[model samples]
Target chain A: MSYKAKFRVWRGEGGEGKLEDFTVEVNEGEVVLDIIHRLQATQAPDLAVRWNCKAGKCGSCSMEINGKPKLGCMTRMSTFSEDETITVTPMRTFPVIKDLVTDVSFNYQKAREIPSFTPPANVQPGEYRMQQIDVERSQEFRKCIECFMCNNVCHVIRDHEENKPEFAGPRFLMRIAELDMHPYDVADRKDAAQEEHGLGYCNITKCCTEVCPEHIKITDNALIPMKERVVDRKYDPLVWLGNKIFKRSSSKS
Target chain B: MTQTTADSPARRQRAQIKERTLRTDQWWRYPLVTFIIFTAFLVYSTWAIFDTSYFASPYIAPYASPCLATSCPEGARLFGLAPFGDWYTLPPGLLILALPAGFRFTCYYYRKAYYRGFWLSPPACAVNEPHGKYTGESRFPLILQNIHRYFFYAAIVIGLILAWDAVLALVEKPVGLGTLILVVNAVFINLYTLSCHSCRHITAGRLNHFSKHPVRYRAWGFVSKLNAKHQQLALISMFTVVGADLYVRLVAKGIVNFPFA
Candidate 1:
């Protein structure tokens, strides 16, 4: 007997939505995403789900499968019990635009607020010199795919809507931190980070880090150092004095 | 060195070499190096608290009346509403700040690094005197270090308050140079704070599968760089705070001017 799988896919627009069930034939080597596409082609035309690169690389297939945020393309149908109902829904955190599509424009807006790279005055474009060791430190943060899975799972924004305006969320902050730690980038956004981006609101529960599919050390490498730097600037007496002396000396010279 | 005949000379030589190795390894067990590093941190932290005036200085140039209690501008205030009042009042505040940094320096991650990279072992355990082994309680105090999450939160809050103070100085007079320095200091603080290991772990926890995206790979690259010399920055970050604090204080005290006294 050929195997059949049941899929309850969310279908509708905006706030109005309902799950429509469709049973699709499955082969041994097929992934869940493939099955969804097959259903879209044969069972439900205009199914209205977003996907790019059947491979997981584009981060376009992010959705909740059976109550878990996952890349649809990566989840294998074989993992589920043959008779179990596979429920597919759009990510819950963001506002749904249409069907599985969500409005992730907020994340992009947060990205713009972060301080961009500013090389030191002495560093020319071509002649910029950074040790292999120094560049290696910032390399990990550059890997972020902007999937916002970390953002989605983050309780700061997910559970608390009030935090949305103030908080930059974990992924964006990690991006800012990545640029900040870059050996050649001289621009600093620490003040903006605190007031505008809401760096202080994160209680460091590590929920964002735990959900990062990239396995990036979001809490340890990005958030903690940013916090430490903030503390150092806020409280360290010597730095305060040095800034005073330097400011004085520079004015005279 | 004379070899005893109770065993072969080669065995005796091997024993002697092993003893020498043990003695060399035992040197760090004396608690002296740890004490020295701790003292150095204390001295640096002390210097950071009192001698510098970054947090307490006025925004204007040639700040006169260095000793006056009310000399501080609104920008120099610590934690928004609280003022240190005088230069002498900062040491206790600094002591409170330094405690966590010092404790975190001896965290499990650092402990593992020290054991493997530096080959340093803990001192003799209190309960295991007969075995002459270090079998101290590892669960409680180490687990207690988890409070770093809370400390991280506090650091962000305090850092913002300081940044706000810096902004107040910038807004009050709009000294271009002072503003630039203040901005730079603020940026460094945010960078250090955001790059914390705890934050990374928390963020990474949400990700279910990461094999598809190339950007995630790049993020790991950035994280690895910060993780490599985290210990060094852990120390430098503490010093940078002191440096920022001193800048604020000296300007507030009228011991120095914005441009120069």
Candidate 2:
């Protein structure tokens, strides 16, 4: 059934803003994004919001609905009662450019810092052989939609802006993990992950896993395994003894 | 309309909105509940450990299981073997508690629990933590969490011992309510132990090609499935272990009696 829904949307630009309340008409089977669109079309044409795909896949319509970081398109309007005043705000981790449109360049910057997949020189294209089981390990991480919800919700950068420089956040760390687990890639990601990419900053709160639109187990499947791998190289005494006795060849020059 | 120039302060940096988080939800409830449960477990476990009355006819307290002390009563001693002999005179709980305790302390799931629940390390998602600095698991004491795999081995041995206790209870006379409790607790403990993240890693981790190792691949597949339910198993097993121990202790004290024992 259609009803009048109350919305308290944050509207501002250049760091100055306030929550503007609007009573808008809503229909059945509509999402929060649909309501925002209605408000923009009817009440506030100047309202600035970032959205690309109305579907959940593109990860463009990410915002905080009632203080939880969620995809605007994925969150159903039916979840909230008609009398409830729904509040919409931008992702807290990144800087805001306008209402609900934050400068997400921090994620882009972190993405650039990670080393892409690198294979051995001798292994030519189309010659790669991998087990389906081995392929499946990294395959779960491949489902990431670059939603940055994981990054935005992660408290390491969400509250601490200073951490933005050192920590790569969950998204790129998962990327590093995916490449490290790749059967073909030979780059030594374990050391780089710990030392450079700030893998140690991640405490595996599983918040990233919680907020993921694709339902990827970011903390469990990717981040935790990578932590354990780093432990093998950096901490394990038995591994240290084995390396000392056998003198294993270093992957990096 | 205010036009923003290139030199504007807002253009230069992030919006200076000052609040811990905009989250209107009851985010504090989770950590608070976690804190209460963990603290209660700690207090209960300490009482159960030091009381030294953890034995009835067919049942033994979980915290005091595999009783290794020379002073352990004949019936409570595991496999009728006193490995420590008279050299160790303390309560059986003191000797046997280390392995399982260490395992849980170093557990990945428990780390998240205590860190958020006790340490308030960003108490909940998107909320500000009280600590000025966060070294995480990068440094000395916290870095020691890497040794969780070692504890996993200890936990396996403990699990086996607990299973043996359950078997002993089963074979003895009529199956009492205590026997059933011990068996269920043992099963839950084994499930929790098997579902460890370290177990998953040891099963499949570091292997570049799973095609070559079919057996390990199958084992990894089983473990990966179990690992998904690790957190739930951790909680259930925690409760079961304590409940099992408490039941046995009550029976020993003659405070509560069940049928068939």
Candidate 3:
């Protein structure tokens, strides 16, 4: 059965905008993005919204749904009652370039800071061998679709613009953790993760983990385990004595 | 641009430029206090490290524990090896000071304190920081902060040495106010060290099934409790370490003398 759905979407640009209300037709088995499209086609054709891959794969439709970070493409209309008013806003962590489209240059800068995968000199690209367990460990972190929801939800930069400089946020830190966990990749990322990537800023709030569409155990598997590795290399006395004698840095390949 | 079906939609219009919020409350108070306190400690420790004459028989200064050099007093010697001999010309206090210093510098709680206090990295939530760019701990010297856990092991050994010194504070005679203060100092150091983030992680982290490792789980619970009071312990511990040094310094300088003798 077709029903009228109420949506409050924020519109405008240059850091100036407002939540404009619209009463749109909601079709059966349709998502929030579909309703947004309907509003664009039927009512306000000039309404600006960013989306691709309506299946939620592209992560381009990321926005705040009812104050919660969510993909418009994944949120089904069935989740809400017919009388509900869904409020959608642009991602808050970055500068809004237009309605629903934010300039995610902060994420790009963090990505650039992370040193690329440094392979072992002993093996060529195809000759590299790794255990299945090692691959699985890194594979879990690979689920990130660059949605930036985790980044937007993170309090480090979400509320505090000043912390944006130091904190690499959850998304990129997970990337560093992934590479650090990769057995075939030879680089000492432990120090870099804390010193460069702002791993220390993370208070283990797990907000990023909660907002992750991929259900990645970002806090438990990646961040916490990385913290453990740092402890092993930095604070353990045996490691200190060994390093003093062996002259090895904390770079675990 | 989307066509407005009517002049304006039925929602709230944002007429003003939306920038980051500036917290209304005196949010600077927290970080300001933190800044003053940490700076005071740093200055005190620097002075305490240089003044090696702070030892009055049997009461070794907390900073100068395990005085393993030739310049040490007969009673101050914890072990007899100043590897470089005469080349190790500095006071014994400076020798072992780096361990505890490193431990505190990389400490998770202290990191927050200093990040907010010293660097003004946001200073507090909802307030803008001074720096335009943040490279985090990924770069050169800041990356060394990752070695905090290693410092924890060092702290354990240092704590043990301090405990021995506290016991030794009364070696000349047990019934003194000086001995009492030393005992209290030792307790504070132990609490702070045990409550460390690394200690908490070592106690319980990386365990998927807590039911199987019941003993580890139990240890983790205890550490977690301590971890909760880490910030408070960190402050108190800093005070006690400096206070212990101050007491010994005053005694050595002929200002503080107990009647226990």
Give TM per candidate.
0.50, 0.95, 0.60
True contacts kept of each: 0.02, 0.49, 0.09
Global fold similarity of model 1 (TM-score): 0.50
User: What value does the lDDT take at residue B58 in candidate 3?
Assistant: 67
Question: DockQ for all models, in order?
Answer: 0.02, 0.53, 0.08
Query: Residue B7's C-alpha lDDT in candidate 2?
Result: 55
lDDT per residue as tens, model 2, B1-261: 767655566754454556777677799999999999999999998888899788887788889988977788898888788889787777879987889999999999999998899998879887878877776777778888889999999999999999888888888844588888889999999999998988887786656678777898888888888888999999999999999999988889989965664
Candidate 3 residue B245 Cα shift, in angstroms, is 0.9
User: Which candidate number maximizes lDDT?
Assistant: 2
Deviation in Å, model 3, residue B27 alpha carbon = 1.1
Q: Which residue ranges in model 3 land beyond 4 Å of their true spot?
A: A1-14, A17-225, A230-253, B1-20, B79-84, B170-172
Q: Put down candidate 3 lDDT per residue, B122-163, tens digits, no spaces.
A: 466434457666545554566667677779989999999889
Which of 1 and 2 is the better model by TM-score? 2
TM-score of chain B of 3: 0.89
| Model 3 interface DockQ | 0.08
Give the per-residue lDDT of model 1 (tens digit) for A1-253. 3489988887755535677788999888888888888988998877767789877778888876765567888888888888888887776667666667766777888888776788778877899755554555568887777778777766556544556778888898887777666656656566566567776655454556655667788877687666545533453454458758767321101
In order, candidate lDDTs are: 0.56, 0.85, 0.75
